[model samples]
Target: MSVLSALGSINWIAVLLAVVAYSALGGVWFAVLFAKPYAASLGRESLPQPAQPALFFGGPAVATLFVVITTATLMAALNIDAAADAVVFALVVGVGYLAANTVIIAINPNMPRPLFYGLISGAYHLVGIVVTALIVVAF
Candidate 1:
């Protein structure tokens, strides 16, 4: 099935709730826990704040889409049927995201602190996991 068709089988309310919760988790993590300190450490004058509501909303929406696609693909490829499989998938994706971010930061030292970026990326992927789990459970 196409990604959209797979996602169409899900309960959107749960999917959205997961996305919002995850996005809020990330926003708080970046904005409060790491934003200023990370920017200062990089000798940056300021971090780029969201100029529009969409900027804040768009990311999680895209992330949710990504999770849906990934989960659907994995479920098909691995024949995943258990909650444990969903959890494992989340962990694997989180690790892969961290590694990718590490490479990106290594290539561009001007990027935010490794720990900060890693945390952000990890949390984002975890959120994706939760969203995927909710979809699988609901469906």
Candidate 2:
């Protein structure tokens, strides 16, 4: 099936749920678990509050939903139904594309600790994709 077909068949509700799940995960994943470390990576004792709080939170939420919408649509297009298939797909995109580029991009910026940024970013991308994929399959 093509992307157009997938869009017709995809369960938007499920995709929305998956987006929320990962978004919540990110909120805790960095904002709480890696709070200090994340701040440290940016060479700051604390992350500064965004001038517009809505943009700060809403921006990522919107991006997350968009990611789910498109990827889940592709999954539907590809007829990704099996657990193994979804896992493999997620791993390929998450690690091969997202994670690898994250390392390179973070390093190129001369980040204080390139590995730290990569690790944090890579973990989120990998886990977020997996969780979203699983939910896409489940619901």
Candidate 3:
């Protein structure tokens, strides 16, 4: 079957829910838990204002949509229909790729406090992937 066809078999509502999960999780993670540290890491005294008005929603919306589509494609590729399978796939992708690379790149010579960035960024991706996977597979 074509990869697109595989995704066609998935419940679209599940895909959307997964996308929303990432944004919602990000809201809690950045705005509440790691707000101060994340801002400080960026050399900002507080959450920096976006230069453009569209950034508040547009940025995360596009990125999350991209991720959801990719995840659906991967699920189709792997024939992953169960939530447990989805979680395993997501963890592998999140930890092995996203979290690892963020740490490596963010800790470069010019960076300050790599640990804080690593902790916050890593948690965001890992948690996001887990939540997305579970929600996508469950419904």
Candidate 4:
């Protein structure tokens, strides 16, 4: 099926909920759970306030939306109505795409501790994707 057709099959409300759920996970993961390790991953003593706090927060929300949309589209296209299949799809996409990309993105000149950053951020995305899949399939 075409991309447009796949999009048409997606449940928008589920996508919205999944987006919100995934974005919220970012807060719990980065701010509350792994705050110290996250800071250290950046080679910092603590979390630095971004000059543009809006971008700091809003950027992830927007990215979360995109991720949910993509996952939802794929789910719809593949006719993944079952929870078990949804989870399998999530794991494959999460590990193969999101986590791998996170690690690759972490390996840069600005990242002093790339592997550490990857461990924290990649794990967050992995869990977030699973949450997203469950939410989407539930609806």
Best by TM-score: 4
Per-residue lDDT of candidate 1, residues 1-139 (tens digit): 5555654555556556656655666667556876776456454637575465775668767765666555655565555567777777766765676446544664465664566555555555566565566565544
Model 4 stretches with alpha carbons more than 4 Å out: 46-52
RMSD of each: 4.1, 2.1, 2.6, 1.5
Q: CA lDDT of 115 in candidate 4?
A: 94
Could you give candidate 2's per-residue lDDT for residues 12-109 as a string of tens digits?
88888999998999899888988888777766656574475788789989988888898799899889998789998899989987788878888865
RMSD of 1: 4.1
**Full-model lDDT for every candidate:** 0.60, 0.85, 0.81, 0.90
Clashing pairs in 1: none
Which of 2 and 3 is ahead in TM-score?
2
TM-scores of the candidates are 0.60, 0.88, 0.82, 0.93
- Ranking the candidates on TM-score from highest down gives 4, 2, 3, 1
Candidate 1 residue-wise lDDT at 81: 60
lDDT of 2 at 2: 82
Q: Please provide, for model 3 over 1-139, each residue's C-alpha lDDT reduced to its tens digit, 9 standing for 90 to 100.
A: 5787876777788788888889888888888988888877766755565575778877987888888877777777778879789889999988987788779878977767777788779879888888887877777
**lDDT (Cα, tens digit) per residue for candidate 4, span 41-77:** 9988565655656888899999899999999888888
Error of model 4, residue 92, in angstroms: 0.4
